[model samples]
Target chain A: MNPNRQKVLDATLQLLAQSGLSGAGLNDVIALSGASRGSLYHFFPDGKQQWVAEALQIYAEAFAEGCENAISKAPTVSQGIANVFLFAAKMMKARDFRSGCPVGAVVLDLDCDSEPMRVLCLSIMAQWQHRLAAHLTPLPEAKALALAKMIIACFEGAFMLARLERSTAPLTLAAEQMATLLEAQLATVSRSH
Target chain B: MNPNRQKVLDATLQLLAQSGLSGAGLNDVIALSGASRGSLYHFFPDGKQQWVAEALQIYAEAFAEGCENAISKAPTVSQGIANVFLFAAKMMKARDFRSGCPVGAVVLDLDCDSEPMRVLCLSIMAQWQHRLAAHLTPLPEAKALALAKMIIACFEGAFMLARLERSTAPLTLAAEQMATLLEAQLATVSRSH
Candidate 1:
């Protein structure tokens, strides 16, 4: 990616995290990226749709990779899930809680105006669910898939609460509860085995 | 309230749930409500801000009340929580999955453009936590509060997933998992006692 184009997408993503799709106007992108209108138009001739789509794809992929790495490296699924929440908390504090998952922000809104973007959001969620379930080895596939759904749902909800309250308490509690849930599942599996 | 005023507020809320804050434009409200521009202004002299605030208050309060009713009528905390999730699932299906919590929709966007509205959202969440905690008798207050927070977080997150996936599977999973967690907590409490 050209430096200017990368800068533009990064800025758009920041805006999307902080203010959502409607807030990532072209002018806001140009201003934040310090890129000229001519440059932005040159890179994203299709305008806001392309900018948002590309930026969200970058963000979602990186997020998925981070979760995968965390899960793959951990000794247990519970710890891996806890580490993911920890990373999310650190990111929130670093951004002063002004940011959230850009994909989540987009999903909360029904007016993303582009069918492809909506599909992208749905695909991102499905990918997250699949990747997380893959790490929960030994669990039946259906159980793993269901657990993965609960984990992601709790995570997204905790992130929203943390942002709204400007405190990471919800994230902390969610992390603990998720750990408990995962441990229970593990215990049940071990007992059965 | 006059029929026209009520119509306008209802329309605004529908738009808020479907498309979020930006999508609930005055023109959209007028068109949906069949209220004239003059009547809209007459009902909401302060315009969109007042309209959104009042509409959200109605929606949030009603939602809270419905949860309270479910909780109060259930045989156990786990069942009560499950009922709340069931109600949420039903609402999503009724709305054809196009609607979500209006408050969640607004919170996802940082550009709500009104400090009071932000404060109102914060208060609404606090009220939910407080009300849910109050229902949790026999548990230590701190534990109750923490559990309440986790429950609300899961509910919001599951609702978002259900909307995006256009399926209630996430909500179903969350409800089941929450019942498990709550049952575990109860077991611990009984053992400690």
Candidate 2:
């Protein structure tokens, strides 16, 4: 991506994070990116929807990359799970709760009938789930898959609650609870040996 | 609420369930309720936002009542927890995943700075959490509170994923995972005895 195009996408993401899809207007995108109207039209001739689709794709990849990075840095799958939570909590707090998982917020807004957006969201979530499953394969496939979905749910739910409450308590508590869940899973497997 | 006002509120909710806050417009509400512009404005001078707020309140109460009803029908707290999942799964399937916990959907859309909407959302969630905690009090207060949040998160997250993935697999899997968590908690308590 060119520097100007990257700037426009980045601005779109920040606006979406702060103001949601409907709330983020085209003018806001222009002002945030300092790009001209012609530039925007040149890049995204289809207007807001196209711009949003591109932005969602970018955000999804970045989010997935971050989770992969967290997993790689941790010594065990359980520790990696904890690291994901901590990383998420830090991201939420730093953005003052304005930012949530982009895929999460967009999926809610996208029409399920819209094949393009639907496919985009599914592919993103599937990738993350695959990464999570990879980490958990060392434990148990079924348990790991189940936990991955639950953890994703917890993370999304906590982000919603944290934003609504304008406090980090929900995310912090979610992380702690998830840690408990992960530990319990490990303990169960260990004891069976 | 008057008969006409109640109709409007109910109609708003139906539209919200299908298309969400932004997608459901005043014309849609009027068409659904078969109400005139005069009647809508009479009940909600501030228009869409006012109607959405009231609709959210009504939905919250209805959801809480539904959960309470499910719990009451069960033979034990654990059974009640299972019942909540079963009932939720049924409801989600009935709507084909178009509907979710209304308060959760609204809570996700609300701006943190919108004090009135924020308070309404917080109160609704707190009430649901309180009810869950109340049902689990016979177990352990701390564990109950934690589980209550987890349970709520599971449902919310599962609903979101189910809708995004266009399948009930997430909800079914979430129910199984939640059941496992509950059983784990119960076992830990029993072992300490």
Candidate 3:
């Protein structure tokens, strides 16, 4: 809530995106954020792990909100899915593929990390899925969950490819495929209704 | 080729899979591998970057071989696709979700890392896509590439989700979608022939 706390969180999240979790150390946070050690520790007394958790929470919340906006603004669910993919592609391209999903970069590095860290990562991921599925409420509950998860997987997958190959082709292709699937599902639902 | 060289390589990779690139340092490698510092530098004079490149090469080779084996053993391309996903699920489950794609963790953590690291990651990713598409030569080249990249993205993305959520649902769903897509494509090719 404090200005210093917000600055520290944003800096840490940016570091996570750029260099990942391990390198997003407390010193990096202090250096990048220009936040004094006193202010940083005052906000995050538990140090690096605590700082990471807070940063992850902030990023995840913003991501969830963005998904909701994308879903709501698109004319159709298929369009919504495509928009999400396209938006990610544009962002990655602009960043020269140097930036990636903060959550994803951190999550990959979490395999042998602490329990608190794992829980934070898992809960954020689960929250993201729930948010995406919420936009698909028109579909059956079971179907919505499956579809949302698949779409999320494709989104995650697209980013990985785009980052590696330094091209947006993979993301574009994923968008097309997801759009097709969404159209087919929506058609079936419409016919049934 | 040396036993100690192999041990050190394996330990670094395991560290990469678990703690990611930044944390998979010389110290972590030495500790996890129980290989002497002298042996590590002896095998890798250029230090961490060289060691990581060797580990990446090993993982890429194993991954390519796995792809070849899966393609050879399956009766159909669609089934081969499913097998890959199923195998990933099994491996993740066995490891209690502690193990992930070694290449993936490194790739994500690569935004601010060295140029050599990015090249190795990109080359390996590109190689995997080419290998998968090779198994789908029946499809038009463009289509095959698109499909293969999509499948790879799904696989990479699935592991990300599986590790984060500590469940195989994302991977399982991705496998189902990919299998269905592959089956439809193969049917079209058969009809055209």
Best by TM-score: 1
B79-159: candidate 3 lDDT, tens digit per residue: 888888988898889988877888888888875547788888888888888899999988998899898899889899898
Candidate 1 ranges beyond 4 A from true positions:
none
> Judged by lDDT relative to the true structure, which candidate is superior, 1 or 2?
1
TM-score of only chain B in every candidate structure: 0.96, 0.89, 0.95
Report the TM-score of candidate 1, chain B only.
0.96
What fnat does each of the candidate structures reach? 0.78, 0.37, 0.76
Q: TM-scores of the models, in the given order?
A: 0.97, 0.92, 0.94
How should the candidates be ordered by TM-score, best one leading?
A: 1, 3, 2
lDDT tens digits, residue span A1-193, model 2: 7777888888988877765666456898999999989999899898887888899888877887888888888887667777777777787788877766666666666544566877877887877887777777657887787778878877788777777767776777777767777887778888888
**lDDT tens readout by residue for model 1, A17-81:** 88888889988999999999999999999988899999999998999999998877888889989
lDDT of 1 by residue, B1-193 (tens): 7998899889999999888888898899989999999998987899888999999999889988999999889999889989999889988999888888889888887553556777888898889999988887767899999999999999999999998898999998899999999889878888898
lDDT of each: 0.89, 0.76, 0.84
TM-score (C-alpha, index-matched) for candidate 3: 0.94
- Candidate 3: how close is chain B to the reference, as a TM-score? 0.95
Q: Write candidate 3's Cα lDDT for A1-193 as tens digits.
A: 7888889988998888876777688788999899999998898899988888888888888878877788789998789879889988898889887777888878887746377888888788777777888888778988888888888888887887787788999899999888877776777788998
- Each prediction's Cα RMSD? 1.3, 2.2, 1.9
Clashing pairs in 1: none
- Candidate 3: list runs displaced more than 4 Å: A111-113, A188-193, B186-193
* Candidates, DockQ: 0.74, 0.54, 0.71
